[model samples]
Target: MALDLEGYLIDVERARGLEDIQTLILHLRDQYGVDHIVYHWVSSDGEQYGCGTYSPEWAQRYVDKDYLRVDPVVIGCFQRFHPVDWRKLDWSSKAARAFQAEARDYGVGRQGFSIPVRGPNGQFALLTVSHDCDDEAWDAFTLAHQRELILIAHYFNLKALELEHARAPEPIKSLSPREVDTLTFLAMGYSRGQVADMLSISEHTLRAYIESARFKLNAANTTHAITRAITEGLIVVGGTSRAADGGWPGRRTPS
Candidate 1:
């Protein structure tokens, strides 16, 4: 039987390192009655890393042959944010077909599902479950556990992020009231001129505040700035504080 996801989330949170997470996925795979569970992440620095239940030989072979370039799952999942069923992806290319053959030859499962996850600073990861079952059986399994699988995927990502930061600790930077205001409005889809009007600042000044926030967040661009801000809780846009400084990470005086 699989571990209870409610209790499992606490285990995920208390996971002290990557190894603990790896063990958890093994337990989760048993819980879901799937053959394998995998988590793969790509960092902003272009570093690729993750853990999974795939056999050691196959995992190494995938890396040694650079299968990532030809793997349909990696290619298709990268383009979307939602959970994907393997049957729906395109596998028409010669290279893709050959890779699929090799994967199956290596004992990879015949049925698969993947969830794409995105996080701060251009980080991306995938949580996948695969098994060797008939189409109808796979469909029933996915339909039954879809919501819990999604929740597990996110919590796993969060713990992974926390562990990474613990190893390479970066101090959380604070944003100013005006900078928070600029990002909040921008995240709401406001144009620069519109944000300027709302903040009672000139477009020139608006640009400065955005640049400052971008620098503080170490974001690559304005869109990245807004994404990073929201992820880090420096500015909460969609939730409570739909408009202004109420969502800023900390209290700040008027600038």
Candidate 2:
């Protein structure tokens, strides 16, 4: 049966705490007919947190076995800027294969899709849904639900960040204009050199600006910087171009 994902999202938005988030995940798992749904986050200080539908025994086993060391999902997703399918990640190592087998035994499922979300202040998160299915069936499922899943991933990440921000010790700073310019072009899939030329700046200067922005935003890379900028409203998507006014080309405000 098809899931009422929209209703679930509304419920998720009303969640008050981590326990509530976990309850929502359990609902999603059953609703989507997936083996598990997991959302894991890491903050700037290296603090980790998560909410998921995985069994307590499996969760404990994962920690006890130090599966993070060999888990391809964690490693692969860390390096990727886009969503990834489980089949695309390398499971070539014996340790990785063993870990996968153990996960399967614990009912974590053989098929999975993961979205990597990077937020301001060195926050990194992953939203994953896994199930047991044939390759063809899984392909169809992912294709059909890809857009919804991406939206859901961002929604979940945003909600988690909001909660974190509410508990933060200090107020977060807004991105500078130069930082927003760099991120805007990057999000539109522009090459660094192209972006530099569009902004009438040298590539070296552009690199400096990007690095500064990354540092200020506590982003791990350019992609993360852009994602954070877009998520935090530092750069507007499909808005008027500030770049056209000789400020910096391609920089638009959100409408």
Candidate 3:
């Protein structure tokens, strides 16, 4: 089914608290005809918060078993900056395999897809949809709704952050002009040396600018700084870099 992103955004903006997000998850789960829809994120400070449509029993079991340590989805998604299919994640370890079987026993799903989200202040989150379906059906569903799901993931994260700071949003300091240029060229697919040359600066000067921008954006690193810049409208690359890669060039896999 086609998602109404405009309508969804309106509803998300109307959300008063986490409870409202829980309701939204349920609605989206049903609308997508998926068994579960989850949004989980960890703050830079290691604080975790989330909303999802999983059964209470499974949720409790997951916590009691400390499955977070063994869950490949969480482990893999933490290292990635793009949407991923469950099959693509490594589930070969004995502990991981056991966790997978238990999850299925609890009706977690036979198939899943997750979108990794990175936000300001180095926050990391995931939006996942899981269902009990064969490979072909799952592939078809993902192809049909992937873009909408990505939009939904970001919108959901925005609302979650808003509610997390309901009193007053932590103000985002503006990037300096040098910082802006550094990020723009990087996002435009320029190598650091190439960007330094284009900006008429040495790599050392460019590195300094990026580190400053990273601090301002509260990003973890250079790639994160570029992506955060794009998402926050701090800089506009206009796909000059994305076109070359056939995708966003700033995607990261954390070490």
Leading candidate by TM-score: 1
Whole-model Cα lDDT of every candidate shown, in order: 0.85, 0.80, 0.85
Error of 1 at 181 (Å): 33
Clashing pairs in 1: 2-31
- Report the C-alpha displacement of residue 172, candidate 2, in angstroms: 11
Cα lDDT tens digits, model 2, 4-45, are 778878877887888888888887777777788999886555
Off by over 4 Å in 2: 44-46, 171-255
Candidate 1, run of 10 with poorest lDDT: 246-255
lDDT of 3 at 121: 65
lDDT of 1 by residue, 27-139 (tens): 88877778889998866554677899988988898888877778888888877889999999999999988988887887778999998888887678889999999999999
Clash total of candidate 3: 1
lDDT of 2: 0.80
Q: Global CA lDDT of candidate 3, please?
A: 0.85
